[model samples]
Target: MVSIGALARLAGTTTRTIRHYHAVGLLPEPSRLSNGYRDYDAHDAAQLLRVRRLVELGLSLPGVTAALGSHPTPGAGVRDALLALDADLAQQAETIGARRRQLADLLAREDLTTSEQVADLLRDLTTAAPGTGPDQLRRERDLLELLETSGGAEGFTGIADRYRAVLADPAAVDRIGAWAARFEALAGVAAADPVVTEVATELRMLGPELFPGPTGSPAEDGGHGETAWAAFLASLTPAQRRCVELAGQGWPTCAP
Candidate 1:
């Protein structure tokens, strides 16, 4: 038999922890001798060692207790539990590795610019549309950085080319310029005017057919294409606007 302090030291645990385990009904309370001191026997030591081993293997107290009561083969349940934990940990590690690889590919040089360009364009669209706020802008920027760094540029470029073609179409250019003017007028009144909303809605509707994928189309992948186009249209200069208008008429407005 050993004193609690001696048992704690031998078991590499604190006396307070042993007391706590007793309080929680995890460990059996020891008998008090005539000398007014508690005495722990070999059985106590073995139980303490088992508890410690279970803890080290990541078993909760409840789980350890259940394993201790039900397991016919000594340490079998604990071993199975540890194996399950190991398998879960391995699966998580593989998922993390896959994400890391994807990030590495996105950040490669050729992919970066196209990703940013697409995101920046989307942000402009959302800003121009109603009920959008700074939170939306921040999210767009975060997504842009992720996609650009994530090697999504090939898909991005294909969408961008389609937008450029749309802008080059003489009829589309005239419509867009007229739409911009109407929007400018509406903005001069109330930024949230019904006309502004109408223009935004029209743009949203046409955007799907024009861009056609996650970077542009609502059908292919929600409103990513529409948002990107809105951003690009928002950033256009007066000269670029004119060029887009002229493109509709089958004429180059000016040199690129």
Candidate 2:
């Protein structure tokens, strides 16, 4: 005979573990003596140790119980459970190995100015629109980076593809470069200036050249794109910002 504490010590586990096994019915609850202490016999110790060893072998509690319930030795049911667990572990190990290889590739990279998807579009823009000044170029990069990094950028998913198509056409790229240069020319001008509307109009007319989809009423993007737009507008001068706002209210179809 032995106390629960003695059985736990023999099993190389804690008293709490023994109680947990009892609660889960993984092992039979021990009988208590008149003094209120749990009593465990040699048979109880053997069963507890079996449960502990099965758990260490990665058998779930229910599997341990099923294995223990089998006559003489663990049955074919337990064997199948163990095989399933082995296959699951093999898949997990492969996933971990693949993740390690991906991490090694990332570590070997020299530059990560932007993600791969955005990098090509930005490179094409730089090459095709060489007349775009450094400041305008920086603004364009910052805006795209902001959108790309934002979780809410889901609403802007097709932007890169649209830009790619436009930049592929030499005339379209020339028109865009002229449009951006004119937009940058409105730094100190007032918001009510006529060129503000003109620039906004130019942007509207350019919409069909990029995205030829049918025009529809402006639809709300559940405030996600709105937040990004507000942040983008913060960097612009009054006329430039108003022009964009005007273009935004109407062009529901255009964004450079």
Candidate 3:
């Protein structure tokens, strides 16, 4: 027989934990000594050790109770409880494995947020126009992300499908590439230069062929369409701005 502190040391647990186990009826309380202090025997220490082992095996206190409460024999109850726990662990492992696979796929693609359809559209655009640079591709992706954020996923899909159709024509693709090159070349030219006017005229001619008519509906925020168009124009060079303005005047339907 030993004091509570001695039993705790022998069982590799704390006196508070032993007291808690006794309060929770997990461990049987030992008899009190002449000094009115609890004296724990070897049986009590063994019981505490078994309770700790059960807890380390992932059994809850209640589960430990059910497993050790078997009067005639504890073997069958412990075996059943362990089998149930093993099944739960297996299910948790499968869930973690599936999540890991998803993370791997996202890492492999490097497009954690973009939808597959949007990714395919970007790839198609790059293939259709060889000179399409990284900046332009990033802008296109940002626009797609904005569309998705603004609750325009369905509408954006329709737009993407239409754009894909427009890019399918080889002539159209070459014409678009040539027009982009011409526009970029005019970046340093005067806004009123003859080349600006010429580019503007060419844009007017190409607009209808390249783009379908607008949806005529307001943007997701009811007026963000106009705001976004204004922002886009603000970002362009003066010559490009002049060309876009002239083209819009010549072909009102071509204005974005």
Best candidate, TM-score: 2
lDDT, residue 19, model 3? 90
Q: Compared to the true structure, candidate 3 yields what TM-score?
A: 0.50
**Stretch of 10 with least lDDT, candidate 2:** 209-218
* Alpha-carbon RMSD, each predicted model: 10.6, 6.2, 8.4
The count of backbone overlaps in candidate 3 is: 0
Cα lDDT of model 2 by residue, 1-256, tens digit: 5888888889999999999998988889878899999999988998888788778989888888777676455566667767878998999999999978766665655425555555666777888887779888778776666656543345345666676778889998888888888988999689998989999888777774342221222254444444555677888998988887677664544333
Residue-wise lDDT of candidate 1 within 1-256, one digit each (tens)? 5999999998899999999989988899989899978899999999999899888877788877777766789878777777777898789899999978767766864435344476446544453443434544444454444334332467656545655565557676556545545544442444434554565555454444342323323565454544544454355444433333333232121112
TM-score of each model, in listed order: 0.50, 0.57, 0.50
In order, candidate lDDTs are 0.59, 0.72, 0.74
TM-score of 2: 0.57
Error of 3 at 23 (Å): 1.9
The order of the candidates by lDDT, greatest first, is 3, 2, 1
